[model samples]
Target: MSITSANQLELLQTAEAVAREKMIDPSLVIEAMEESLARAAKSRYGAEMDIRVDIDRKTGRATFTRVRTVVEDEELENYQAEFTVEQAKQYMSDPKVGDTFVEEVPPVEMGRIAAQSAKQVILQKVREAERDKQFEEYKDKVGTIINVLVKREEYGNVIVDLNPGEGVLRRNEKIGRESYRNGDRIRCYIKDVRREQRGPQIFLSRTAPEFMAELFKMEVPEIYDGIIEIKAVARDPGSRAKIAVISYDNSIDPVGACVGMRGSRVQAVVNELQGEKIDIIPWNEDQPTFLVNALQPAEVSKVVLDEEAGKIEVVVPEEQLSLAIGRRGQNVRLASQLTNLDIDIMTEEEESARRQAEFEQRTKLFMDTLDLDEFFAQLLVSEGFTNLEEVAYVEVSELLVIDGVDESTATELQMRARDYLEAQAAKALESARALGAEDSLIEFDGLSPQMVEALAKDGVKTLEDFATCADWELAGGWTTVDGERVKDDGVLEPFDLSLQEAQDMIMTARVLLGWVDPADLEPDAEELGDEEAASEEAEA
Candidate 1:
């Protein structure tokens, strides 16, 4: 191959076409072409010579040049890279060291290898520019939907063609059992954009709950207009879904707006989802009401909420039990996710039986612990006394609520409860002490009397021993109990601590033992102590 005046037009035309095809700026293509030409010119100029190339972006004409730095004789490293002052003086009258001299050279005759090298340079630059463009375009578009064409499927991964470039839809992001064919147009949310060695990766997803929410935003005008908001969504993909919606405008019913007129709006979404059934429910501020709404189409006779435990018990009629639980617990599971509460569903008959058994158990407990007759125990149980702890903690005024239990009887029962608790606590503390437990360990804030006893038995009998214990060990580490892994729940049932709480207790123990500076613990403890001492002295 050879370059001539006639073929310069062809070079310019080829550069433009390649730039357009590769989605790169034409200037970059021209620069790449020049660099490739310079490399080829190097073969003739001598490999050690510094060669450069410049191409006109407008006219597609190429120019060759050689660059050398002017240097003193002793500073010259290579004769080809640097021109001594004597040689430089011939080109310029006042040549100075560190000055660069660029001399124009005739264009090289294009060769087979030279053309191929130029082509590779242009292709490499174009690819880099394309990746940069893809990254910039899609980085800010993550969490938003984009239209794509299914280019092909490779090992269960779908190759999607976007307007910018080709993207990947990994198998994990695909909805369960959803299938795609080549040339099929689809809509997905841009989950992430990552720059890798090959190119920028734009990941698409159809399974994210956020993706489902975006679809609703597109389909529901109310949601887009901010008249309604999607609080949450739970999907059993390709089967069923539940969405919770709330309306900011009083006049607009959020659920009705999402469902559209005669189900047109929801049906549109359903059609796009391949006939996935959707239940749009109105959100409520009251969690119990919201939970009931989340589990729709099932008649809930009653809902018992235990907010502290994050659990809700729903009792339905015997005939509606299956419906409430759904086929394989789907309905209840979705409801739990939407409401952020664990749900337990039972039949009305089952709830009644449970209540009766609880009543008998509590009545018997009162009889044994309070030494009360059957009638009095029954009255105490009816008045909401479940265990000896409640009897020991309840106020005298509350005990008076029971019929035939006058102030005298209430006072006597309260005395007995206090005596029992004190006796039990003293026994635990004495046992802890007898087992070589330090007073500091026995009196730690978070450690119960029974926990101190247990620690003593385990040879952790001092403040240092308590501080060194792990959160899991302090809270009753996992132990095999009746073929099940259960935490020790401390030296006694219900004396469990969270990991953070246990860590805090350890820090407190360290501070008390002078292992940690009190100043560092609270920053003002020393000052506060001084102020208190001064005040006491003044009072004295």
Candidate 2:
């Protein structure tokens, strides 16, 4: 193939056709042609010479040129592509070292091998441009639901046509046991879009919880209009799912609206999910109240929530236990996901037994530590005084309210409790000092003697060591590892230290050691206060 004057316009026509077929910019195809021509020119001319090609966008004319750069005699390397500045006087009045000399050169004829090589180069560039265009077209479609035509199946994965590109629905991302044939229309969630060496990969999913939520948004006009909001969703693929919703308008019931008239709306979603049963629950600000609603179709006798641990205990009647837990604990599992809390379900009888065991344990502790008889200890426990600290530090008037307890008896009880606690503290202090604890830590006002002992055992024996500790290290926290929350035990966690309290104590220690400036924290505190005030106002 040669760039003949008669067929020069054919180049522009070919570039336009290729660009239209690939749905890419025509200029990209022309650029690829220019590069291919340049490569052929280099092969025809001396390999060391710098050959270039320019294609006119409108006229389709190809111009070829040979360029030689002027350089110092000592720096010149390629004799064909570079010339000495002194030798460049023939081409220019005053040539600089960086100047280039250009002369018109005839275009090279593409032989059989060269034509094949140029074809590959154009194909490579066109493919790259096509991939880039596909990536840009689909990247913003992530998290959206789209209808696609199923192209074919590779192994267990289904490839779908996105009109301009193809998406793969991985086996794991499909609804349980779902299968499709070629040309089947399927609705899927655009989970991800990535650009790879081969091409742009669009990952589609039918099992995502977001798919369910989006379906409802499409079906329910209130949700689409922001009158009702889906707070959370959890799905078991083709089995069962749960969704929590809230209504901003008081007149609109979120659950009722989602259920639709006579179950039409929810039934549509359920049918799309292959009959996946869905439980629509109302959203609540109170976690325990919300959890009680989440565990539907079962009567809950009580709900005990541990906020710090993100756990809850639900007590139900014995007959309702099976219903609350559902088949293979599915109900409780879905409820846990919906509420974002670990749930422990038990019969009412189990709760009673557990309460009895705790009451007896508290009674025994009072009897052993306070020199009280069994009856007196039980009475104290019944009066809600569980520990020595409560008994020792409680107001005298509170003790006087107890049966058969006057001022004198109250005084005696407090004295005994205080004595025992002081002895325990002194023993802990002695042990901490034995473990190389310093007076600097012992004198820290926020830490208890038992806390000092615990710190000493953990090799944190000085105030400086405590100041260097992270808040989570002293207050404990939950960490997400491999999609599961694991507990990170803290040195001071056993003493009921909260994260905020630990942070404040550590900052105080740092200030005392002159390791931190108080003024540096003032701006942060003010900003936090302002943010909190704004949040409260918005809530109101």
For candidate 2, write residues 203-299 as lDDT tens digits: 9999999999999999999999999999999888999999999999999999999999999999999989989999999999999889989999888
Give stretches of model 2 more than 4 Å off: 68-90, 93-101, 509-519, 524-536
- Model 2 vs. true fold: TM: 0.93
Give one digit per residue, the lDDT tens place, for model 1 in 1-540.
655545667777887898788777877777777778888888878888999987766666777888999988898888897998889987887889988889888878877888788778877878888889889889999999988999999999999989768889999888777899999999888999899998888888887778888888999988999889999998887788899999999998898898888998998888877788888999999998998898898988899997644578998999888888898889988888788777889888899999999998988877776788889888988887776767877888998878888999998898887787788788999998999998788777877677788778888989988767676666444454553334355432255455567768878888887888866767487888999999999999
Which 10-residue window of candidate 1 scores lowest in summed lDDT?
Answer: 484-493
Instruction: Spell out the clash pairs found in candidate 1.
Output: 476-488
Angstrom error of the Cα, residue 413, model 2: value is 1.9
TM-score of candidate 1 versus the correct structure, residues matched by position: 0.77
Query: Quick one: best lDDT, which candidate?
Result: 2
Give the C-alpha miss distance for residue 238 in model 1, angstroms.
1.3
Error of 2 at 55 (Å): 0.9
